[model samples]
Target: MSSIASQSRSGPRRGRPRDPKTRRRILAAASALLNEGGIGAVTMEAIAERAGVGKPTVYRQWPNAPAVAMAAFLESTRPLAPAARGGRVLEALRIHLRKVAETFATRAGRNTALMIAAAQNDSELAKVFRNHFIMKSREIGRTLLDRAIASRQLRSDLDIEAALDLLYAPLYFRLLIGHGPLDAHFTDAIIDAALGGLKRRRRT
Candidate 1:
């Protein structure tokens, strides 16, 4: 769940051995702090206190606050199931978007927003975030688009990256700008709008 890129260090590592429960608590605590106060508020000592674990416990898993926040952000986005193949493309898309919408409304979601912001200046962190979170989401979208194209239901010439942009870019846009609701209906509407153009035109 830790998404922060690891750093090479030249000394004995300090921290307790990893435990799943402890790790979950720490992530949950990190998420709460992140949601309540943004990234600036998540200190190592604060996470330790919130998670009810020693500072060493947190250090064992994450070297810094960004690391903790990244891990929590990954956990938040991790629950979404990829769009199922062989299902109707639109419905599958709707479900995928719905899960994304639900997660986007949370603190973990907000932490992810922070991750995006942090990555703007931190190239190393940007690489890690793209490799794990963004890459996985893109892969999922790619698979679904491939199936859609093969089914003759969508245009064969569809641009994979652009298609995904149509599906996801708007959601992230709304999340950042707060111009509209990220609700279930909004997800459905976006899917409908994208498919309207993505679908193959009927021949007369």
Candidate 2:
């Protein structure tokens, strides 16, 4: 049996061709609703009303509000911390992480925290959030790690899984726990610390 966290996207329904403009409006509306009132406010009716479309229009694209909310989060955040390619891998990753810190320090971060709390009780929401948002974001980070390792900037024997955790776990910890500030300074500290352990050691 498929786990709740492994649900896949629904197939397209037979209807009018999906319009790019309408899709954008729906996603934007959902994002706004999530930011303003958390995931509780992102119902199909609310999204349709906000997007100036019918309920069926929203339903046709997403099976439920959680799906729409996750989609909106991904759409809105994709550009904020895009994966860096080429150039010095560490420097590129540092710059990328700074962007991530800035993103986490905003209202979106609050919405994410809300989503996480909500997902604890909503299995469907948890699935989509983990598979789509969290895993996808980690995939980008993994690519950068692969590049760094290939370039020998990082220790060849590094454990990618543990290394990824070390690199990003603190940011999420701060974001979720709210104990410390999530900013460029914090990002630099994480990079410095993670790199200190990840970098290849000089042999005497």
Candidate 3:
């Protein structure tokens, strides 16, 4: 399971043991609302009614609609298959990028773009989204890069931060801008180009 799943359930909770079914219902309801009406459509009452639960029940699980929306988003983005252990790091990264591109073309991805746009004006949402979701995902990317560097598969002088940006930023830019196809071909092209710049130089 991805850390996103754990993060959604993180921090202290003050409620009875959470029922998985109830949680799924709530997330599903929240996702539906987001798809139907964007970020503004999801409300505690709306989620509860859609989930067949009371407002208090929703509150018991999440503080507000944004939190719930973020949770729903996180759930959708999870299972972003990690690089296979002991495989060539770049190969794993290639696979990972493909998954990212595929997901970015999904309804969840559309909702993510909307939430990010909405976050521009909502500081609290922006903070939580960055701290919990974006940062966590970056950490995952960072770990993979660290592995590549350690194995000497990438240049020792490689700037991990910039490398990550190179690997993923294009997909996101396309995702947000609606410019091009977010498909395997694009995934391969982007990763190949980025890796071409980052790979270790073979000595003659």
For this target, which candidate reaches the highest lDDT against the unseen true structure?
3
User: Which one is best on TM-score?
Assistant: 2
Clashes of each: 0, 0, 0
- Looking at model 2, which ten-residue stretch has the lowest summed lDDT? 1-10
Which wins on lDDT, candidate 2 or candidate 3? 3
Tens-digit lDDT track for model 1 on 1-204? 223544211211554445677777888998888888887788999999999988876776666777777767766666455646666865676787787778777766756776667658766665666676666766777777887788787899988889998898888888877688888999888888888899999999
Candidate 2 residues 103-123, lDDT tens each?
A: 777776667667777668677
Supply candidate 1's per-residue lDDT for 200: 95
**lDDT of each prediction vs. the true structure?**
0.74, 0.75, 0.77
Using alpha carbons, what is the TM-score of model 1? 0.81
- For candidate 2, the per-residue lDDT at 26 reads 88
Q: Model 2, 194: alpha-carbon shift in Å?
A: 1.4
Question: With candidate 1 superimposed using the best TM-score fit, by how many Å does residue 8's alpha carbon deviate from the native?
Answer: 14
Question: How do the predictions measure up, each by TM-score?
Answer: 0.81, 0.82, 0.80
Across 1-204, the per-residue lDDT of candidate 3 in tens digits comes to 223334357621666777788888999999999888877788898999999999887777776787788788877776354755775877877878887778778876777777777668666556665665556666777877888899988899998888888877887789888888899999899888887889888879
* Runs in model 3 lying further than 4 Å from the true structure: 1-20, 79-81
Clashing pairs in 2: none
Error of 2 at 197 (Å): 1.3
Assess candidate 2 and give its TM-score to the true structure.
Answer: 0.82
